[model samples]
Target chain A: MNRFDYIRPGSVAEAVAAASEPGAAYLAGGTNLLDLMKIGVAAPDKVIDITRLPGLDRIDWLEDASVRIGAMVRNAELARNTAFSAAFPAISEALLSGASPQLRNAATVGGNLMQETRCAYFQDPLSRCNRRAPGSGCDALEGHNRSHAVLGWTPSCIATHPSDFCVPLAALGAIVEIEGPDGSREIDLAALHELPGSESAGGIALKHGEMITALRLPAEATSFAGHSRYLKLRERTSFAFALVSAAAMLSMEQGTITEARIALGAVAARPWHATDAETFLKGKKAEAEVFAEAAGIALKEASPSGDNAFKITLATRVLTRALTLAAKGTPDRVPALPASVFMSSEGATANA
Target chain B: MTLSISLSVNGESLNVPLEDTRTTLLDLLREHIGLTGTKKGCDRGQCGACTVLLDGKRINACLTLAASVDGTDVTTIEGLAQGDTLHPVQAAFIEHDGFQCGYCTTGQIMSAVGLLSEGDAGADPERIREGMSGNICRCAAYPGITAAVLDAERRQSESEGTSV
Candidate 1:
């Protein structure tokens, strides 16, 4: 909201050129960017609006049914896309399992990927946040650390990447198509985010003035009937940030798990890939007991904070429930169903 | 730094000159355009207080930049009612008594209009609830909002004599 020059450039070259300024940022759907600007979190000298760029909002269906989703595709569009909904339901479900309708409509894929951490201390300019202002002293490390990251977190930063879509993308190994001073390059989405404990220099992978062009996903990214669900556990259900979220993708063959890609969110600096759990679930029969065991494998070595110790237990429960429901994969449901808060509500009422 | 933008609001085109910085679509409608029907609740996207139809899609006007919409069509809550006649969504809201203080009424109505246009079937209360979750009424008039959206959907289906 501060006095800054804003330009709506039609071409990517012009937009990138404008964004190359010392203190300039590309504005997509300003749902996140403008909010930060208003709160003085992002103080850009010049704002480049590139939401109007043509061909940037496309969802290209490549050969063999692979998809290349443009960066500017709105969250709502990605959620409602029939092809994505059918093929990689996790990606579609991830997009739908985010903010409200208005926010999704105005929030672009690029903006969502670039959305800053949702740590209260980081957003509050008055508060000290290591992520916002390096070495400002992280208040959340000891102060109201309920939502702070438990895994892959260091003393420097405890903030988690507040994105639901990235979990599925990371687990599926989606490639990020980027356009910057250099030509386009398809970088692995999993490699795009960095762990705070990275001793390597240039901690963040996404460079300055390098706009996201598109996201390409393989055709066989997920099975056609692969059961997947994004179960998010939070303080409140309707519209609250996640405390512990789970994205479980199950590929079963004859009641046996062929592959299980489980990603944990809101509990780590990035989508915590449950590699051990996934490896244990492979070739095992998909059952309640197996799910419980897999969930245990996922959180066995979890290092929860003082206040966030509950997340370990909560995430285990969520993953168990998600895996159970995903295994069933039933569509028919009844309304006004008689259901316990945490109990299974299947077959509570007739569909009709 | 001033920018002149034209918007086709409510079936009418209006050219408004705005300062290069600061003013939003919400302010343009409420202050400059003098269409105060759209209530400003949170001045943020959290509350659906400034919901408006931007090219047939619902978006928080507060989050929208005025200069961004150079030649886009916008429909505010005031546009839903045609002088004396109200749209089907508006009529359903009236019949269901979907408002209280009427401050959040405009935003609720605009959101309802967009939600119904989303082509969501199943007139059940739960479906309607999930669809209209963006609109928050401090008056606790959520039941009415759900009922209105369901009622509007029902009417649309009844007119077709088939499940919509």
Candidate 2:
């Protein structure tokens, strides 16, 4: 890790001012930033610690029943919050599915949202990754691209965002509140992250010195909150990043879907919100065949690389299973494929 | 820039005057404070060998900057035992042979203690295994480790019931 100056700003204004400086990065939970620094992937000249900033660690309930979670609230705290979990079980399940109990105890909402991709090439300084160095080239495009993106990927980068929280947030239509040098603004969670389009493509759409203050989960007064699910498929049972994950929420009235929201992870540069599939599910019966059709529509635009071509089929199956589980209102059911399934020639042929 | 920070480590308040702001909590414990009980397996957060309780929450010390933890209380593996009497978690580990090489013992013990306090470790073996997944035991002492954690949790609850 490179040597740098550290400052714990007492106020959000002070933190924003410090962060606006060149080579400055906000430090909260340090779970991802510090690891990136250790690998020489990120070398910020100044790290402004924002964990101590006032009023950024509380989980508040609004009159409208919406929950406001501070940016500095640790993942463990949010996952264990009874009210938040009651309101948004998918969010709780997503948070618990990530990292470990130790890491979740320290990782914060804002830090998780701002985490860099876990693309091997992007983490390796020796590899030519366009995200690491503009116009350098992308090694993952041809070399060991099993975990590369299948959607919203450009030639400059084929990396997927490795966040479990964002997928649920996108499906739930959560809003992000950010404070910047100019003032404050709210951005829909789905619009917060951007896809890699070119060599200069950025991951997050935050302005300079803009720090995430809180995330607002809209009220679950509707039926969707009671019928939401998050399903992550990973190599191992715990402490592993997602190979393919899905978050689905549905509002059913008399066994028919009134509304549906779905998002896919580990297959795109950002959370792949299945808008087309969501539209298709509305007013349709909550059946397995309907879910399978929606899942197929969701992956219709997926363009997979050589090794990650499996993700398209994996994502479809995962999304279909997730939607079926959501319709049944089972938020904690995690369906994972065996490791041998990915290695078997028959599995590849069937998926292909 | 050298910054002076106060940290309460293992129930002792110490003022550390440091020159490098890049010093991690793991380095401060092992190198500066001379608490070798906390092992540094991976300087990064991948390995949980440097696990410690920051304000009663388990965190990877290697990923935590010492300066960022100013005015915070940290509980390390050395802090678990009172005098010569070992903590219940520590005792259970010994009773169950929870370690093979024992290099990951400190972190495993610290993480178990933290897990017990968090009330996430029930009597279920799968839950204990998942809760302790952060700490990697290269010797594959997972069965023993799981048994030790569950046993410790049972003992702690039994003692609490008796006292009540």
Candidate 3:
């Protein structure tokens, strides 16, 4: 890692001012940024430490019973919060299923939102990765791409977003609060991540020197509290990234679905919300056949490469199973990945 | 630019001058403070050999910048024992044979201590496995490690009960 200047800003304004410098990155939790720095993936000229900034670590319950989570709130703290877990179990399960206990203790919501893809080629400084260097090239497009994106992928890059929390947050209709050099603004959580486009042009649309301040989940999303499931299919039973995951939340009335929210991860450059599937499921009976049809609709846009063709089938099955589990209110019954997915000769572990 | 940072490690307050602001807390402990008990296996935070307690919470020391943790309380494996008496977790590890080569033992123990403090370690073996998943044992001593954590939790609670 390169030696750089460090500044511990006293307030959000001071932090934003410090981050206005060229090649300055905000440091919160340091779980992902520092690791990338050590591996030569990212080297900032200045690191603005925002962990000490006031009012960025509190979890507040709004008057409408919705929750406002500070961006700096650690993942472990959020997962262990009784009220948040009760209101949004899918979000809690997604957060807990990610990384590990020690990592969750140190990882913050803002840092997790800003994490880069776990593309091996992108991390290797010698590899040709457009995301690492604009217009350089994409090695994952033709290399070991079993973990690459099968949905919303462009020729320039096929990397998939590695976040498990963001998928559920997107499904929960959370909003992100940002503070930039100009002023403060809010954006839907689903729009916080973008698919890879030409020349690696797609990512969070934050302007330079903008920092995420908080996340707000709307009160209406709490209606899915008892009927939500987060199903993550990974190579291992624990401590592994998802190959295909689904965050499903449904509202049922008289055994019929009134509303549905479905989002996918590890299959796209961004959290792929299955708005079409959600629309099709409205007013339909919560049956396995109905769920299978909805799952098919959700994966209709998938364009998998040769190496990751199995992901389409895997994602379809996972989504169907997730919808069924959510309808039954049995989130704990979500199954693990089969041993064959990991033991197959061509399916190497994309994340280690 | 160089910075002067103060830290409270194992109840000892120390003021140190740092010339490299990018130095990690793992390097600061192993190289500068001469506390080599905290091993540096994977300096990229993937491995938990550099696990330590920062403000009573277990975190990867390798990922933490030394200058960023100014005035915070840090505890490492070297601070677990009081004089000659080993901590309960350390003693339990010995009784359960939680090692083969033991390169990851200190990290495993510190993680267990932190887990118990966080109210995670209990009679449930699955929860213990999940909680200690961060500390990877290459020797595959997971069965022994799980036993040690459960035993340590039981012993600590028993001692507390007796004192109360």
Best by lDDT: 3
DockQ category of candidate 2: medium
- In candidate 2 the C-alpha lDDT for residue B6 amounts to 97
Instruction: Please write out the lDDT profile of model 2 over residues A1-352, one tens digit for every residue.
Output: 7899998899999999999998999999999999999899999999999999999999998898788899999999998888777777777778888998889999999999999999898899999988889889889988988988898888888888899988988877789999999899999987888887755655788987899999998875334777877888898767899999998889899889999989998898888888999999999999999999999999999988658888899999989988887887743422222111232222232122
Considering DockQ, where higher is better, how would the candidates rank from best to worst? 3, 2, 1
* CA-lDDT, candidates in order: 0.78, 0.86, 0.87
Candidate 2 A-chain TM? 0.92
The better candidate by lDDT, 1 or 2, is 2
- Give stretches of model 2 more than 4 Å off: A220-222, A331-352, B162-164
Minimum summed lDDT over a 10-residue window in model 2 chain B is located at: B120-129
Interface RMSD of each: 3.2, 4.6, 4.0
| Span of 10 residues, lowest total lDDT, candidate 3 chain A | A334-343
lDDT of 2 by residue, B18-78 (tens): 8999999999999999999999998777778999999999999999999998999999988
Residue A226 of model 2 has an lDDT of 75
CAPRI classification of candidate 1: medium
